[model samples]
Target: MFENATKQLRETVEAALPELNTVVGWRAGYDPLHMTPVFIKNAGDLSKLEWSPFCVQNLSGYLVKDPAVRAQDPSKKIGICVKGCDSRSLVALIQEKFIERNQIHVFGIPCRGTVDWRRVMKLGPLTGIQSARVEESRLVVEDANGGHTFALEDVLARKCLRCAHPNPVIHDVLIGEPVTPRVAVENSYGEVERMEEQSLEDRLGFWKKELDKCLRCYACRNACPLCVCQDRCIAETREPRWLTQRVGTSEKFLFHFIHALHLAGRCTECGECERACPMEIPVTLIKEKLNKITLELMSYEAGMDPEAVPPLLTFNPGETGL
Candidate 1:
């Protein structure tokens, strides 16, 4: 599947290179087992592109950063590869007027699931595994001792299991044949629902317990492709001091609240924030609850279409659905 996808992706980029300034996709990292975002300027570099479960990072964030290409030649388009959630971010960006639709050439991939490296590490202590590969929906782990097989579903990130739109929501060219959408289950926000049922004090205590483990790494914010506002982040400011830099329960609570509030209507629920956290915080739960509120109160879903405006962006006096 990856081979065919890679071939088609390379061909697409090669054909579009004359009109595009850059083609962004996943390239193998210094460690062959991992993948990193690769920006290809020339057609010849397309051969370096690859895709797999390890290609989990959202590339949409880079679109807003291509100032050099845009400034030098605003008409020249940029090519990008996107999974389901990443496509939504593209749509959201377009809706928010962050980027023009014509400025991007999107190649969409139907993602089955992505691996959680931390979860994989938990299977056993580091055993010198040189590389890992996916074959027939099973992970093939290779090390000095040989290969072992583990069911892909068992080790896949939890977000993937609950994912509804595995196929890109928007795309100019789709690489692989689409698969059947899994049965829509209510489990996606189950954890958040359980938390909601707890008393206010209990819920606060629950979050306090989790936030206590935080080292204030800001990995969640950094990993988020939607968190484009880096210059004036509330965490770093001091004039007004919206949040203290000191690592404590008060500061952590403030951080989480501001983070969730900022992502109220814009979050695509990509689960990158949770995946990137070294402490394994359930960051998506907060985003999921916000999503539920957005749906219930405003009847809106983020990143479904480039033309669809977010409810929070507009005021409707008659809107009282909740």
Candidate 2:
């Protein structure tokens, strides 16, 4: 199904390359079960471009967080292929003025869902993956030994399973037919709602247990597209001396909370933080809780509209009920 879409994507990018400095997309990773970001500057490299469930990285991050992208000639627009969630991150960056809307040529691809490689590996325990593909709501993998099949739901990334926007909110060109979202907008925060059912003590205990495993590697912060304050991050800065080298639950709790608080009304819930965490922490959930609060109190969802301002970022004199 995605073969035709991939073909169209390459054709579109190739045609647009004359006016673009680079077109960022995905290519096969070290294994069949993974995909990595690829920068297509010339037509010859289009064959390496791919589109599949394994294309999990949010390419939007490169726009704001990558130095290479920053070094490009400002006059030449950068092209990008974005899934629904990834497009939201792009919108958030545009809303924050990290990159101008006119600076990008977007080839929006409607995503069905992306595979969670960790989930696939866990279920497979099956090794030496030679090839993998999705067909008829199932993931089929061929390894050295033989073939294995797993239900799509069993291997799909947690974020994709709950995706409320399968079609890009903004795009210069659409690559494929739009897909129906797995969940409705009103039901997007089901996970956050479930956690809210826990008592206060339980909630605190839950965070304590989860955060204790934190390595403080700052993977979550670095992976976030909106976290553009890398040079003066509180976690590492010694001038103000916020966090210490000590390994303790309280310190970890503080670090995680501060990280989440920084993105309160800005996170697009792209799931990069959680996916990047080596400890398998559900780091994005921290931001999700904040997102839910912003939605309920201010009736705003981040990154949905490029022109709209984030609720927390602006003030209204007549606003009430804080």
Candidate 3:
């Protein structure tokens, strides 16, 4: 299925290349075991294109900085391939006026689930695993020793279990037949609910324990597609010094709080931040709490549609019953 999907995506790029300045997709990384986002300027480079569960990074973040591409250019466009979550980032980018709809061609893939390599590495030394293949009901893992079969659901990322949009909401070309939509589950925000019931002191203590593990690595921020404010980040600014450079518990807490607040109504709960955290902090809990608040109070979900304005950006004259 992935081979056919990649072939179709390659053909689309080939057809559209004359008018497109570049085609952005995942290429096999130098490590051979990983994939990295690649911008293909030549048709021959399409041979390097590949897709699999490992292709999890959101590539839409690059569109915001592609200076060579012009929205009005009749002879040029940028092509991007996106999974369900990545497509939402594109939608949010359009909604925020970061990019225009017609400026790029989108190739959408209906993701089943992606593996968390970190979790897989924790299973063992992985002495023999040469490659991984996803069968209908199981993952066929190959190693130097032999082949082992594991249930796909067992190794699937936690975020994928609660994902509601397995199929891309927007696409110029969809690569495969849509899979049955997984029933929307409530588990994504479960941790937040548990925390909310705790006493204020208990909640504070719980986060203190978690935040103490943080090394101030900034991996979470770097991995997030929506955290585009690189220049004005509170962590780096010195004039106001919202957060000190020291790696103390207070500084870590402040950093996490500021990060979560910045993404209060904007986070799409992609789990990129949590996944990227070296400390394995459940950073999604903070985002999920904000997500629940945004949904309940403002009646909004971020990145679902390009036309819907973000809750924080609009004001209702009658909001205060004035």
Best by lDDT: 2
Note the residue pairs that clash in candidate 3. 128-143, 128-144
Q: For candidate 1, what's the RMSD?
A: 1.8
Question: On residues 1-322, what C-alpha lDDT tens digit does candidate 2 reach at each position?
Answer: 6678888988999999999999999999999998989999889999999998889999998898789987998899999999999999999999989999999999999999999989999987777889999986999999988999999999998999889988899999999889899998678888899999999999999999999999999898888888889878988888889888999998899999998999999999999999999999998999999998888888889899999999888889987656
Better of 2 and 3 by TM-score: 2
lDDT of 2 at 46: 94
Instruction: Arrange candidates, best lDDT first.
Output: 2, 1, 3
lDDT of each: 0.82, 0.91, 0.79
Please tell me which model should have the higher lDDT, number 2 or number 3: 2
Question: After aligning candidate 2 to the native by TM-score, how far in Å is the CA of 30 from where it should be?
Answer: 0.5
Q: For candidate 1, write residues 1-322 as lDDT tens digits.
A: 5677778878887888899878889998765356899988987788899878888888888887556545646678888999987899899889888889988999899888888877776774547778888887898788777776778887788788778778899999888878655535344666778889999999889889998888888888877777877667888777888876677888888897789888898898888889889899888888889987887678778888788888888877887885
How much is the lDDT of residue 163 in candidate 3? Answer: 81
In candidate 2, which residue pairs get closer than 3 Å at backbone N, Cα or C atoms, i.e. clash? none
Measured with C-alpha atoms, the lDDT of residue 316 in candidate 3 is: 74
TM-score of each: 0.94, 0.98, 0.91
